[model samples]
Target chain A: MYGNSQFDGSAAFSGGGFMPSQAIPTADPSSPAKSREAQGLLPLTVKQIREVFQASDDKANFLIDGVSVNNVKLVGLLFEKTERVTDVSFVLDDGTGRIDCHRWVQESLDTKEMELLSNGTYIKVHGHLKGFQGVKQLVVYSVRRITDYNEIPNHVAECIYVHCYNTRTRKMQDAPQATGQLPNPAVNTPSKGYQPTSSNHSQFSVQPIVDGMKGIDKIVLNYIEQPSCIGKENGIHRAELAKQLNVPEHKIMEAISSLESEGLIYATVDEFHFKSTVNG
Target chain B: MDTSNPAAFVNAELLRMYVGRRVRAVIQVLRNDGGSIFGKSTDEQELVVKGHPPNPPTTFVEVIGIADSNRSIQAEIWTNFGDNFDVSSYNTICQLANGDFKHLFI
Candidate 1:
């Protein structure tokens, strides 16, 4: 039996489906490698593809407006088609810009798909972004001629929506969460170099409750744990907490109730105000 | 030869600014007279495309060429988009590509 194996025989474990917050790893889940693996195909324009910048010291980690992008879906006019012995290369022009794209000749099906496309054919390509000699290009996974004319406009709309989400909307939503994550046990210890003994003591006391909480609950707890909230005897008001989190009052109420049930927070002054049990 | 300058996506109105420059527009062919095409732009404005029109004109065609005037284009390329094209969606893209998101394009 492979009972002792790391992968084991957990046939029921659905990797792509929902998992409870507690089961999810609490560490920096958005590590560049992990986030890249989790990011699905980003619908992007040829201009955005050309504009992607190397985000980290590692040359391979590319980002479009701070959003990690790996696989991408593009719709454009196939301008030039060339067939080499092992790969088919073409240039795609989407009106915004043009970029070189290539697909490997792996099978008869690939060659057949390549044969269907010619110069000036509108096509949809799903591919990975790659850099060769400082020039960005696509290593295509699948290419299909766009039979439906609506797909062109649809692709444009999709790319704009994705662009806004990556550059503006998602960043606004993630700002508080990024600050909230600084107090994580894994990240807190090293930063408290001057007071290691006190940091370790607090870490041990807070680790269990912090480990089980996530998302809005973790954010609410972190806000309550702030020195300003903890120093006051009345704690912070529910309205203030809701405003700080930019979430609906009902959602804050739900998170507060869940945290209270777990004994991580306690009412102070009145039921309207709450403080973290560990630090307050 | 003209590959150095990218063809900007333009509507009947946007075409005015790019006079004598490369532009692309999808137009619903209203009439074809062999050497020229009289069509309606995605924005529903009339446009004259001077080039060899498609032998059997489709409902819609995308023309890429130099904007000769405010209402006319000297087409260098014509792509036959089959019948049943969505004009409204293309209209929205034209406005977005030239307006708020102009920086995204060349």
Candidate 2:
């Protein structure tokens, strides 16, 4: 009964709202995003997140644009504010709504990335929702400040496009069951601007920092520069690079440190977010 | 960034990001109801009152209150950029004094 709808990663890009764009050269057969899509952990937009908060019943799990999800991915402004309780929280404005993101500090883990975030910045956040004293909040998994302001509009458009795609797919899936007719293969085909999984608005304004690099480092640089815009709020995390490149996290970190020292790449938004000097 | 306590997006930045330092906004006047001219954000997320603000559209405004429902924010005009104000586009930000915007929504 669940054969067609088993969600065994066939719709990897569909669920996460991420398409395997040429921008992200995760050419490796075993990629983290692919695995996550197989696992069905899709991303949610901030506006959809607001709907999650509003539609929740006694802190219940909510659906984001027809997909039942607990995780969310949002892009927005990071405003600087004083520490209210000495606890680390980042307030984000994605134009649709304002959300507070919380990430617990692990003493054993490196928090240099967290320290890199500052106010008056644009950023991308990945995490889930939680309730604090009746107010809805986000418990973030990752946060990066943005450099390319262009990604702002692009991100918004992506959220809308993905939501529409998912909604259409679900409706198509449901129709077959309702009518007992064979599912239409054409229904799963790409929508307008859905080819190659690249965003319609991702024409990059910057280039990769490749002045001096070799082997994996060059490949990593190429991958990080995949996003149409790159800078403080628009750079890639070392871990993200690792997943996309199918490389070890340590390797990406090492490459990043070297590139940073050469002054070839710098943090346009904060320490964690990087942009090539050539782009500036 | 401490994630344990989530509260980094503060009120001050909201004014700047959503509104602006100069409080520049393209306010859509809904109607002029005698005493106070009613206006709102192009998205209708905010309710604005013209002439209620003292300064022209160039300076700053005070965030007075937000509705209990959290649907809107309320502020009194502190200043304006100029006496004459008009918004040409919906998304285009009309440069107003930071004080003219009372309550800012998304």
lDDT of candidate 2 over A189-249, digit per residue (tens): 2121111112212212111124235677677666655545354466666666777789998
TM-score of chain B of each: 0.93, 0.29
Kindly report which residue stretches of model 1 are placed more than 4 angstroms away from their true locations once superposed.
A1-33, A36-38, A57-59, A174-280, B1-4
Predictions in order: chain A TM-score? 0.52, 0.45
True contacts kept of each: 0.47, 0.02
Docking level of model 1: acceptable
C-alpha local distance difference test of each model: 0.74, 0.45
Please tell me how candidate 2 rates in CAPRI terms. incorrect
Candidate 1, residues B40-103, lDDT tens digits: the string is 9988999999999878989999999999999999998888888899888888888898888776
List model 1 lDDT by residue over A186-213, tens digit each.
Answer: 2223222111122234444354346557
